[model samples]
Target: MGSTVNMQKQTDKVNLFETQMTMPPTSEKGSSGNVPEDDPSFNPFGFVTDNPSSRSAIQLPETPAEDGNVGQMLYRTEDKGREFGSTIKSGKLRWFVRETGSKESRRGTVVFLHGAPTQSFSYRTVMSEMSEFGFHCYAPDWIGFGFSDKPQPGYGFNYTEKEYHEAFDKLLDTLEINSPFFLVVQGFLVGTYGLTWALKNPSKIEKIAILNTPLTVSSPVPGLFKQLRIPLFGEFTCQNAILAERFIEGGSPYVLKNEKADVYRLPYLSSGGPGFALLETAKKINFGDTLGQIANGFSSGSWDKPTLLAWGIADKYLSQSIAEEFEKQNPQNVKLQLIEGAGHLPQEDWPEKVVAALRSFF
Candidate 1:
């Protein structure tokens, strides 16, 4: 999974890109409010020094090896049982698996699914916190995001509902993670796919924690996302890297902050980032029937698993009113907890609240 450090560094680079676009190469020092730290091109912020101590609690992992790998090679090597790597079966895709906690202290595992245009990096803080709570957190970067192999256009990317479900099941099997674990999902990742999976295999999920996630078609969908659901224009706009960047920036509250925005942009800067799978997600967005099926499945009482809704009050994409409605509808089954001062990505905005809520549930 991607870390905070990688995101920050990439964001800084993006800021530099913006600077270069606005200023000439031979511009004088501090002309565009850009100042150097270790190198002329490296600026953490416009005027402040880029110091490590000033970074947020979520530290970035060390830079990967020069082989263009995204995570530790040993985690993927055959000697390590190919734990963290890609494997395809039945036309379904499975990605990395990082096993945490010892067998003796294995409280329970958490299968975390991340949101759109992101990989497991979105759950880095949550994963770390869960680890501390003695849960074996098994988070995977989905097939099209993070370190996984990005299939050529038309070969993959536009994944069907069945394909996503099968891929997730295969991933769990590949990693030997059986049932009775908590299912933690966020954003678009869980709305239909994760919820459907949980409904179909309710016995496997102990409890479900949804963080600022939209569960139904009626739930609020961002305007840009709504546009991306269109046909020709949708496909055209989704393919544009600039548009993707803009969407990401708009979704994020810290896009203007140097440290935070950097972390958010790393995976996008990575090869094969946010182009194909994002389009597929948008396409799936317009398929209201599928989302309805998921909602219906949940409403059918198929899921006996305990449900917790930890919503960030400040989330722009998903309105708090939805959470209120959810609680009003499922008063007995769902517990809603509001997280103050957090946006759509609560783990980034308020890690402590996310951690505390999970701890209370788990």
Candidate 2:
């Protein structure tokens, strides 16, 4: 009888162990018994979903508690875009312009044009550094971006390449920037447009420096642009407040520090304008045509102006070979300086290295 009872108990213990192992995961006792959606520790699977309760760049808390958070106030100035900038009337539109150097700048004027989904904010440090060197630096929040006016896509501003070119020209005229200026262009869409603009008016540009922008026909179109082409999805994707910062992080080797991330995220949080503007611009651009224009425009004999390829070797988008090919095409004038430890947006990734290259080249 004792043996039989002991055997039964052993079987019961085995059954209990199996039962515990096979049981479904659940939330804490106070909550519903469904599998916990967040907190990997609460769930047996040890994986958490992208829910708000989790901390990530996408779900960054807008307000971090601090007595005198200079980082917090950084966004209030629209990422220092307002403090270092002013609004100017250009073609009946107001452009939020960042001018670093004095009117009587000793070095020549330098215009920095940023790519899509990003604004002139990327150039804040670069511009500041460049200005100190006596180069009159101007970085504008392209209309519908940053602190600039975001007009609806109809009457005067259509967000087309032509309209952008026109608006830019008018902005230059309004700023009275007539002399040939050194140009630093980077990123996508509008960045490529800047190159095309240079091609169209070679006489207006003294020298050009290109960062990690797509230059070849084979350059792949990023998913952001592709998603923006979809009807409903595009609209939804564009509205993401964290889009710009995410894009930068996705492309770069280093994660953006929260302080810097806040600067990039500020514009999108303020209004829907930057997102819509980017969406319109993305959908309207013909990548094939634009890439062809850039490839051919800057190829061997076609491009004469001295050019510098301050390429970020770690760029997730364009590879080093792209720069190598372009340099090979124009071995004489097109100089290539591969920035190590940097990614797609080299200037933002390592401005000191970029400034070093610029100081040497320009």
Candidate 3:
């Protein structure tokens, strides 16, 4: 918690109504043929032809700096209040920030890390709700899966636990944010980024919330994940276009809504998509080691921070036993909360339950 602050000054606002009167129409509907030379619409002002020799001024919008550092562009939402920012110092890393309410009304900040095949857009609906709850939410789109820059082959798409930890530190520093808040993680990202943040800055973290996330490999991984971990086959499969199509088809069952399957698959359709990143993640991050460290930390009874587990009962990739095992191992540190009628993407399936659980924990 911190002191309340007022809203900052409003930025640029373009007037489309005023500009339309001076601008000439470029084309008309159902006009298939080229315009006649004498037509008024044809080079009416001769601006395009006259400006051919003059270099047009490229107008780049000004992005607000935090701590004197300018954030790279990833994407922007319709509302303009939410924007995605990325950085590529050592590697590609992206984050989504919704700077809507006044600083004084910001109850807390929640940093969300998305899983594979999904980006910050996946949390758009949830972010709206959280923002109303007085939280300045930040959700990062891990490299290779969003508007963030995609690294070429042999350049690694996966983020190691240590790398994510450092990126989070830089993100916070650049944002000039220093406050106790909650960490919300999902899917494989939970292991890479979430666990790293929890371990590195336990004192700063106020609470931990996980949904359908696997911290440990309690059961054998699904064949898809296992296949992605294989050496040559993994690389070949990840880079193959057909495999991405197949993955999209297979992943439909794990999402809450049917339409979401396509949304989740959008990133993989591009070259070097989520499949490539997934393969890299398996190669770089030591899943077993991370899970073991988490288990050890929780079992040692040293962590006093409140932990909440909200797992989708229908999760195809992860099982219920994993949650039970985590609870059994760290009964004193965790509060197991079940989410029914949800699959791998519980936040999409059960946003209410997820928010309710976080409220209780925080």
* 1 or 2, greater by TM-score: 2
Estimate every model's Cα lDDT from 0 to 1.
0.59, 0.77, 0.56
Backbone clashes for every candidate come to 6, 0, 2
Task: Compute each candidate's TM-score over C-alphas.
Answer: 0.71, 0.80, 0.67
Q: State the lDDT of candidate 3 residue by residue for 1-362, as single tens digits.
A: 14322221211111223223323243431253434556645544332112111111111111111112111111211122224443334324454443333346557778777766456655666676777788777776665555555565366434566665776677667666588777878766433467666776888788888776666655445566677788888887675433422332232232112123323434554446566666766667666776666666765366777888888776767788888987887788787998775567667655666777776676
In candidate 1, which residue ranges exceed 4 Å CA deviation?
Answer: 1-94, 153-158, 189-191, 240-249, 256-267, 270-274, 285-287, 300-302
Residue pairs in clash, model 2: none
Model 3: what TM-score?
0.67
Q: Give the range of the ten consecutive residues with the poorest summed lDDT in model 1.
A: 47-56
Model 3, stretches more than 4 Å misplaced?
A: 1-102, 153-158, 189-191, 217-219, 240-259
RMSD in Å for all candidates? 8.9, 13.1, 14.5
TM-score of 1: 0.71
Off by over 4 Å in 2: 1-83
Question: Over the full model, what C-alpha lDDT does candidate 2 score relative to the true structure?
Answer: 0.77
For candidate 2, write residues 220-244 as lDDT tens digits. 8989999999999999999887788
